[model samples]
Target: MNFTFEVLPEERIECLRESCNKLMAFQKSVASIRPELFDTMNFETRLLPSMEKAIHNYTVVVKNNDEIIGYVYSNISPKDTYSNEFATFFDVTSVNKPYVGCLSQFYIKEGFRKYRIGSRLFSMSLDWLKEFDEIEDIFIFVSNGNSNALEFYKRKGFNISHDILDGFITVLRN
Candidate 1:
């Protein structure tokens, strides 16, 4: 299957809706594997809004035959106001530090996993964050159970910063 990777079209409602659907599906998939890592709230009421907000903030999605098969939500912002499931899991505290980029949400459809789509999405996000010179580093939290993701990030040069709850917070310097 052919896959196209690009920034999400936040200006288009249709695109946003597609992204929301993909996120919900991704959430469900994760919940099955690690229920504790996902919220028990409704997708429409809780998760969708957060996904929409991140799309508006900064995000990328991969499409196969015009269907959203993968996505990576990220942002370059101050650590204080940037909140996401991963960040919140760590209960990140506000600190007097420069702005940093975050790989907040990332998902790739099951069947598409072997195609390197997630890596492509991550590389794209890193390139986008590089546009902001103030972003000196990028952070991502991977669940300890998700060994594949941890290995992938490590292969990409991200170092494990520390253990956070049930996961490890990793970082990559730009």
Candidate 2:
């Protein structure tokens, strides 16, 4: 099936809310396998707020006709040096170049995993980041034990740049 992607508008609060709830539900199910894979309340209490603050966000949705099967949301900023997680990553590396993009979230429904939806989301996010002119590289974190995710990123030209105890950080320099 062919999927069309687009940016979500603010007026579509219902769509966003539904998608957010679905994403959280799916993540929670996955978190059960590795309870430590997620934080207890970060998504609803923190990240969602952060995402809301960045109104110029992107939500790439994969649709099979009229239904939305999956979606990915991302927020980018050069001033995102506030979080300890970002600080920890910066300490081990250097942003010697001009541009760096961070991916806040990338999610796909389980039934649609084989459709390259994740790749499309990643590509669209990176492409959108480039519109800033200063973003030449992209960075993201994946669970340490998510070997499938690790391998997917690797196949898409991302390299393991840093490894924390719980997860590994990967980057793609442009």
1-174: candidate 2 lDDT, tens digit per residue: 767776776455356555556655555554425444344434465356656656356667767777777777666544444245533554323664543566766667667889878888888887787676555556766644456776877887777766554443333333
lDDT of 2: 0.60
Off by over 4 Å in 1: 13-34, 41-56, 82-96, 166-174
lDDT of 1 by residue, 76-108 (tens): 556544455445532345333556677766778
Q: What is the lDDT of residue 15 in candidate 2?
A: 61
Which stretch of 10 consecutive residues in model 2 shows the poorest summed lDDT?
165-174
Q: Against the true structure, what is each candidate's TM-score?
A: 0.70, 0.72
After superposing candidate 2 on the true structure, give the runs of residues whose Cα lies further than 4 Å from its correct spot: 11-14, 18-39, 52-56, 79-82, 85-87, 96-99, 168-174
Among the numbered candidates, top TM-score falls to 2
Show pairs that collide, candidate 2. 99-136
Supply the TM-score for candidate 2. Answer: 0.72
